[model samples]
Target: MYCEITYQTTGERWGIFPRDIGEFQARMSIPDSINSGDSHDTIVKKSVKIEIMSCSFTPDEKNKRHREALEGLVDRLVKAGWEQMTERGAEWYNIKFHKEMQK
Candidate 1:
């Protein structure tokens, strides 16, 4: 059996901190048994795409410093293993950041 998994964030309130985010949703389409003799190689081959939609934000000089500080904090978190997804093909991983004010 073939399957796909998707993860998304909803009702998100983007800010300088990670805790300011909202709920996350993940959908999985995979077999229950690993002994089914099927391979998940295709899932790894298709490449994963992440999308953030319907977002708006603007930063001024004051907020710019805050954003930069947030970036450094996120970098430390990634090094600490906060990452949820990793690529099988690459030795390195990917992370994304956004500058937005959530209401």
Candidate 2:
């Protein structure tokens, strides 16, 4: 599966795999490839995308992970920028309410 991570601030985007979809993971970590910042606090996160192929996991598990990943991104984005939005394929989930961001 393929996914995209769009930045609401710089409008910069990138593509990542399943493990790269969440926080504290290797790809999005402070010392991972594609990292644009030196510190975690200064790192800018615009959005994250994940692809799930098979039905090995339950819906609840999938939802939980997705939410956790999103929340982590929001936390990072709060310090990086105020305006951010995420679009999971065709569905859009606004994290501005949880963390005061422009959109």
Candidate 3:
């Protein structure tokens, strides 16, 4: 099984590939540095999409289940204020607010 996790942030769209649903879930559950209270930012808001592909399931029922799981995770993250950021946006944010972000 292959899972593609897409994160659409303020100005960036990032894609993460997880080997399976378990890995995807695990990654989603882990908090980033900003969310862990190590950074000044309160929340990182991001829109998420998960795409799953499985060869075993003929009808691909597993994909639906995976999508549901991903949706749940995304909802949780959004509620927590995890905003998405594009690469250029991130760079600009970093450069524009490097001093604040560094703290």
Quote each prediction's TM-score.
0.22, 0.31, 0.30
Top-lDDT candidate index: 2
Can you list the residue pairs that collide in candidate 2? none
Candidate 3 ranges with C-alpha deviation above 4 Å: 1-23, 26-62, 86-103
User: Which portions of model 2 miss their true places by more than 4 Å?
Assistant: 1-51, 54-62, 83-90, 94-103
Task: TM-score for candidate 2, please give it.
Answer: 0.31
Mind sharing the TM-score for model 3? 0.30
Report the error of model 2 at residue 82, Å: 1.7
* Best of the two (1, 3) by lDDT: 3
- For residue 65, model 2's alpha carbon misses the true position, in angstroms, by 0.4
lDDT (CA) for every model shown?
A: 0.31, 0.36, 0.32
Report the CA-based lDDT of candidate 3 relative to the real structure: 0.32
Give the local distance difference test score of model 1. 0.31
